[model samples]
Target chain A: SQTIHQWPATLVQPVGSPLSLECTVEGTSNPNLYWYRQAAGRGLQLLFYSVGIGQISSEVPQNLSASRPQDRQFILSSKKLLLSDSGFYLCAWRTSGNTGELFFGEGSRLTVL
Target chain B: AQSVAQPEDQVNVAEGNPLTVKCTYSVSGNPYLFWYVQYPNRGLQFLLKYITGDNLVKGSYGFEAEFNKSQTSFHLKKPSALVSDSALYFCAVRDPRNKLSFGAGTTVTVRA
Candidate 1:
């Protein structure tokens, strides 16, 4: 059985503060990792995806950046956060190769004030 | 580019009556469809997926979906509705570009 874990279930930070959200997966290796954000009354937006270590594909231009430091460890970071950066952040992992479904982690809710 | 469309913003159903939440999709290759449910303040839960053979895919919580190639639709259905079934339902398609293009979710309200 595989499970995804994200930290800082809820966060409150001042504007322009640095941000870091971590996601790790257990029971799977070489899984494709993704980061998605959901705003209020909006659909999930793909932010970044990593197919392998040191290789990441960013889908949107934003203040956020993602890194795959280890095979199963992904991190979303921002040097300076803005009010627009506030939202629910989700991390997901899918099997390598051609797979449709993505197993998501319990999201991290960030409130920028 | 593959994409999904959930036409309804909300669906109201009476308990014990059949319910259908509509979905339509567009993909380049064979469409791999999926249904997910999100409870309030919770992550999306996987319901079902259509990959290869069967058109009628059954999933958790007594939910099922039918894949239609000609109509380009995959509608989620259940024989009877329950109060606990009320939640936000999302329709998705595999972009195969390693992304799941999801629809703006539909909120289903099961009236007791």
Candidate 2:
């Protein structure tokens, strides 16, 4: 079975701090990866998606950026975090197929003080 | 512009009764609809999806959704509700590039 792993399950940083959240997929290759952020009482907002290594499509313009360094590794980074960046960060992957549901990781809760 | 609308902010039903969470979409091409459930503090879990062929698709946790192209809606349904089903439900539509556009989500409170 495939599994998605995200690290630093919870994080707290002051405004203007650097941010880095990692996500990795297991038991699958050549998958499409995505990054989403969910604020309190709000639906998820798509941040970025990667079709392959070095190929990323950004949906929302914000303080965050994402990278697919490997087939199964995706990273979300920020040079200077803002208080608005505080939210539940989620990473997802789907099989390289026409019809595939997104599989999500446990998610990281980031709190910017 | 592709989008999904989950009309209701919440739905309430008693245990063992029928339940529904409405969803509608607007897309140019064929609509790929999906339903996902999320518990508090947990990641979203895929419930069901309608890709092609069948209008009625069954998925995990005894949940199902009916696709109506004419109405441009894909509403999720279940015969008997469980108290454990009380959680947040989301309806999503796949865009032209297979990207998902989700609604604001609906909270289902299945009272015991």
Candidate 3:
């Protein structure tokens, strides 16, 4: 069975502080990974997606950035955090097939102080 | 290029009653639509999807969706609502690149 893991589960960071959220998938190889953010617990906004290592496509323009160093490891980072950056971050992955449903991680909650 | 819309911000239903979450979408080609559910402070769980063939698609947790191509709508339904069914629901459309475009989401509250 495939599973996705994301961390840190919860974080409280001050403004201008650096941020890093990691996600990794197990039981799959060369899967498609994605990063999404939910603001105010409502709509989901796509942040970034990677089809393969070192290949990331950004959907929204923001201070946040994503990197896929390994086939199953994806990292989301920001040099300086802002108050508006606080939200629930979700990590998901889909098999590298024509038709595969996405699987999600537990999620990471960031509260920018 | 492909997008989805969940018009209602919230839906309230009594337990044992039918539940429906409406969704409409637009796409240039054949649509690949999906439904997901989210609990508070958790990740979105895949419920169902509509690619082709049958107009009615059944999914996890006794939930199903009807794909109406004529109306460009895919509405999630449950024969009987439960308190556990209260959560946030999202509708999505997948583009050719396999990127999913999600709707604004609708909050469902199944009262006891």
i-RMS for every candidate (Å) is 1.1, 1.0, 1.1
lDDT for B65 in candidate 2 is: 92
* Over 4 Å off, model 2: none
- For candidate 3, report its TM-score: 0.98
Q: After superposition, how far is residue A74 of candidate 1 from its true place, in Å?
A: 0.8
When 2 and 3 are scored with TM-score, the better candidate is 3
| Retained true contacts (fraction), each candidate | 0.62, 0.57, 0.59
Candidate 3 clashing pairs, residues 3+ apart or interchain: none
Model 3 off-target regions past 4 Å?
none
| Candidate 3 displacement at residue B38 in angstroms | 0.2
What ordering of candidates by TM-score runs from best to worst? Answer: 3, 1, 2
**Candidate 3 lDDT (Cα, 0 to 1):** 0.95
lDDT comparing candidate 2 with the true structure: 0.92
Over A1-113, each residue of candidate 2 has an lDDT whose tens digit, in order, gives 99999988999999999999999999988999999999995599999999999999999878899999899999999999999999999999998875857988989999999
Give model 3's docking category. medium
Instruction: Summarize candidate 2's per-residue lDDT along B1-112 as a digit string, tens digits.
Output: 7899999999999999999999999998888888999898888999999989989999999999999999999999999999999999999888878788889999999999
Q: In order, what DockQ does each candidate have? A: 0.75, 0.72, 0.72
- Quote the RMSD, in angstroms, for model 1: 1.0
Instruction: After superposing candidate 1 on the true structure, give the runs of residues whose Cα lies further than 4 Å from its correct spot.
Output: none
